[model samples]
Target: MKYLSLLLFLVSITIAGQNDAIAKDYYNKGEFEKALHEYKKLYAQSSSNINYINQIVSTYQQLEQYDEAETFLLNILERINYPAFFVELGYNFQLKNEPEKANTYYNKALASIDVNPNHVFGIARLFQSHSLLEEAITAYNKAKALKPDFNFNLQMAQIYGEQGDLEKMFTSYIEFAVSSPIALNNVKRAINDFITEDSTNDNNIILRKILLKKLQEDPNLLWNKLLSWLFIQQKDFKKAFAQEKAIFNRESESLSGLEELALIALNDGQEDIALEIFTYLINTAQDIDTQLSAHHNILLLRTKLSNKEDFPNIKAQYNKIFEQYGKLPQTLDLQISYAHFLAFYDDKPEAAAQVLDHALDLPLNALQEAKVKLELGDILLLQEKFNKALIYFSQIQRNLKNSTISQEARFKVAKASYYKGDFKWAESQLNILKSSTSQLIANDALELKLLISDNKYEDSTQTALKLYAKADLLAFQNKKEESIIWLDKILKGHKTEPIVAQALYKQGQLFEEQSHYEGAITNYELIITNYRDGILVDDALFHLANIYIKQFNEPEKAKALLEQIIFNHADSIYFVDARKQYRALRGDAIK
Candidate 1:
């Protein structure tokens, strides 16, 4: 008997749900008369069902049966005393051009809110649905007054923003963030819609004043963190560093945030501030790993930012660090970086090879030895010792089979082969790396493979391709002027060849790397103009956009280029980055 009852109950629910779905389908198909007929039947079966009643009323309104909608709303209001029904009746009458009756019902809805604080939400939602911003604000304020812990600040902030009350919007967002800590990121996102990197902008000044005032009134750590975030948004790393320090000291947390800030500063070209942050961490960080990382980054920053004349001093500092830390696994990255600095910048590949060879003698794990070998192989390849480089790279591949480092070693081998004019071997290695676990390596392998295969058949002797590869190797070796010279040879001699686009793109990259924006722009624009459908078109567009935005401060031109990538090259590897940059340049809020 119980099983029969359960089956019957489910059958009844199924019938009712099917009836509801049929009515919805009718409404969606614009067969409102049929929908009304179905909903009226359902309402008769369940007279107390509010959903059925609301759907019937909405269907009436959809069919422009405003009088019927008003009648049903009035009847429901008499039965339930729901404040939202009054607003619905008012809207129905307004739709029927009965302004006086609409006003009366609207006033009743507002008056009904005072009878029950919880009804304020329904009244506010009704007002918001009708775009009555001021009325909705009053209703929400009433509810908050009735319930002190009520959190409508985020909603109010959105409304205030829509109403152009930016100060109030800012205040409301901050209040919401204070009440709900997890919503801090949301608040920052909302602020990003209006804020920009210009420190002298009005919005920035207003935000700064508000933050300063809050800090003076209440010394909360959230304010400090937010101020730090604001400074970062403005690209004011020095001020951001000060605020992050305040947050760290107040909270006594780990140095993770400070470390991240330093990296951000470094990436943003704030070398001095990043150096200061790293110096502070090296002296104050409790963990040895953090100290070592800071030391490594400091050297990296010096190598990137310091003048060539300071190479000897930087070398002496590296020696001092190696002497203090000794040759251990913990300091291996710094040691490797020092080797790279010596080889690439100081033109001391022999010395760089010697350092790595000594580091390789330490008691190291497989990965560590692989890393050292990779660097050694690179230096060897740089010195044109392709056979020696191949040996080291092959050792890593044998030791760490099926690993990311193995794939990296294979890529180096292919690169070395390509540089040695052994196209057949290089093409074989590159084909295997097309499915590499690392997307970057896979893309690189595919690109190099395409370059070799595409240009190999263009010329019988492959002189242009060989020249381009030598130029690429020179660029890799930091011999920029020499690389340009080699590239110029191809550009002048092989004007009609497909290699011209490749050479132009490479020259553009070298110029961009050297901060020669106009030169880079000229080459990139040539690729865009002359080789619009070529493989490097998107690359040229993206680099040109980056140069315009970051160096030339011409966001409009940058936006145009990014748009080209976004619309013209959806399948391009730069598609995602281009879209993000396009939105950011257009001042969209970034989360």
Candidate 2:
């Protein structure tokens, strides 16, 4: 008997829901008479359902029966204490051109809020729905005045924003964020629409002024953090770093925020501020990990900016760090970084491999040991010991099956095979890795696979491909100059070949590595002009645009080039970055 009753309740609910959908469908299709008939039946079955009441009134109005809507609202208002019904009645009378009656009903809705302040929400939403902005604002203000505990700042902020009053909007949003810190990120997302990449934009200046005034008055860390975020959005890394510093001093808390700020500045090419932040971390960080990370990045930045003339000095800096820290287990990552510097920067792969060999002797976990072996394999590959590198990579793959690091090792195995001209095994490995869990590894595998497959048919002997692989291997060995020369040979010998575009891109990268900006631009421009339909066209365009921005100080040209990728090559891997840079260059207000 209980089961039968439950089943009957469910069946009735399904029938009612279907009836509701049918009424809504009829109303949407402009069959208002039919909609009104169905709504009346539903309202008769459930007289307490406010939704059915509202729909019946709306269907009456839709069918030009405003008097009927007024009658129904009046009859229902006594049974339901819905202040919003007064607004709806006012709307119905106004639709019938009874202005004085409409005003009376609107005033009645506003007055109902005083009797119960919670009625303000429904009344204000109804007023706003009818485009009655002033009435809505007045209702919210009246409720707030009557009840001191009411917080309508978020609603007020949206209204003020819609009204083009940014000052009030920003102030209300700030107040809302302060009152409910949990919604702080949501508030930031809301306000970010008005902010742009331009630091000197008037909206940005206004937001800054507001944030700064709050900072002066309250001395709250949230204000400073918001100020920092605002500065970051404006690309004002120096000011952002200062705010981060103030927050750090006040909280004396974790260095994670400061670390993130440093990386942000670094990524945006604010190298000096990043270096300062890193130096500060290295000096103030209490933990060994933070200090090691700071030291690691500082050395990396210095090496990247250094020429061969500065190589020995960078090595001495590394040695000084080791002398101070004594190559302990905590310093294992630093050791691996140092090995990479030695191999890739200092022309000492053999010495780099020896460092990792010593590191392998240390007692480490599987992940730590795998990390060391991965770098070791890369170094061995740089030294042309492809089989030896594969030994390490294969071990990592076997031990950590299906892990991200294992997939990375698998990718490396394929790459090493490609560099050694073992195309068949490399192709097999790449085909498997095309669906890797790591997108970066999968992308790399697919590109290498395409490069091998595209050129394999053009030459029966694979002579040109072998030379290209040799050039690639040379570049991996940090022999950028030799790599460029070999790529030139491929360009000369295989001028009509499909691999020419790849050769040009590789040579352009080598040129950029050597700071030969014009040579890089020339090669990249060639690819853009001749290979507009090719896979590397987006890459060429992006790289060329970057050179224009970073090297030539010609953002207009960069903007134009990036626009091509935005409109033409939307599927390209560089499309997102191109759109972002393009928008920044164009000073787009949209975030």
Candidate 3:
């Protein structure tokens, strides 16, 4: 009997929910009479439900029965003690063109806030819902003044923002964050909407002045954190690093913020500031892992800035770090990184393989072992030991099934096959990886797949495709001049083939990497003039524009190219970046 009753109750709840949805749909569709009929039935069963009551009152108003809404609201106020009813009454009066009576009831709602400050929420939300923003602000401020403990800063900040008072909004958000530290990120996210990437932007300046003034008034680490975040957003990494250092000095704890700031600086191409921050971390961080991370990053930055002559020095630095940290499980990531540097830059795959094999002998977790094996596979792939590389990559997939690294390993498997001229197997692997969990791997896989798929049918021999793959492999081996030479071979032999554009784009990229700007520009221009409809046109345009803007001081040409990207290549991955750069170049007013 009890089970049967429970089933009946569940059915009743489902029906009630369905009825409410139907009533809302009808109201939205302008069938207010039907909505009112459904809402009346619901209100008869649960008259205290605020949603049903509001719908009923709104239905009456939609029917132009203002008197009925007023009577219903007044009766509810007499029985229910809900302060929001005063707002409903006021709105109904306003609808009847009775501004004086509306003001009276609005004041009554404010008076209820005076009676109990906790009543401010319902009363203010109701007023705000009716677009009575000033009344809503008054209710919140009255409650705040009446009860000192009440935290209405968030609400008042939102209302102030709605009113276009950015100064007050910034002040309120800061105050709320200072009082409740847990809400700092939420407050920053809200503040972010009003600012711009240009530090000189008026809105950005407003936020900066507010943060600086707060810092002067109170030497709080919170202000420094906010200032750091703001400067990072503006791409002023040096200033952000200074602010981060100040926060660390005052707190004397928490390396998380500092580490993240370094990564942001690195990703933004502020190599100098990233190096400075990482150096500071290496010197000051007490935790072994943090210290090791800083050491690893410093190595990477140094290598990026190094050339063939400086490779020996980089090797010495790697040795210095390994000597200090010891070749153990704790230093596994740095070891793997070291192995990669040896193979890719120093052109010593044998030595790199030896280092990884030694590291593999250590006691390591599955993920760590997989990481080491992934690097080993990369080294083998770089050396063109395709079968050996496949063995390691396949090991990762079987050991760490469905993991991101496993996906990466799968992609590497496809790449190895491509390098070996096994296009059929490569395409098969790439098709599965089209939906990879790692977006970078998936993008690479798709690009490679498309390259093979499009050109394989053009020639039975695939001679041009083989030549292109060989040149791409040379480029991966960091032999840019040789890769450029190989790409030239393809251009000479297959000028009329579809692979010519790809070869041109690849050679352009190699020239750009070598800072051979004239050569790069020549290649990109050929693509622009001859292959504008190809997949790499936007890429060629963007890189060419960057060189003109940064290297040639030709802003007008850059702007024209960026315009093409905005209007022509809307679906390009670089569209958003291009639009932003274009807007900045055009001197559009900061948002």
- Reference-based lDDT, residue 451, model 3: 98
| Alpha-carbon shift of residue 127 in model 2 (angstroms) | 3.0
Candidate 1 residue spans exceeding 4 A from truth: 1-63, 72-82, 107-116, 120-123, 306-308, 422-437, 453-456, 545-591
TM-score of each: 0.84, 0.90, 0.88
Range of the 10 consecutive residues with the lowest summed lDDT in candidate 2: 582-591
lDDT of each: 0.89, 0.90, 0.91
Candidate 3 lDDT over residue span 33-134, tens digit each: 999999999999899999999999999999999999998888898889898888889999999999999999999989988889999988999888888889
Top candidate, metric TM-score: 2
Worst 10 residues of 3 by lDDT: 582-591
The better-scoring model by TM-score among 2 and 3 is 2
Measured by lDDT, the strongest candidate is 3
Task: Show the colliding residue pairs in model 1.
Answer: none
Give the clashing residue pairs of candidate 3, or none. Answer: none
Task: Summarize candidate 2's per-residue lDDT along 17-93 as a digit string, tens digits.
Answer: 99999999999999998998999999988998978988898888878888788878888988888988999999998
Candidate 2 colliding pairs, count: 0
Q: Kindly give the stretch of ten consecutive residues in candidate 1 with the minimal lDDT sum.
A: 582-591
TM-score of 1: 0.84
Sort every candidate by lDDT, greatest first. Answer: 3, 2, 1
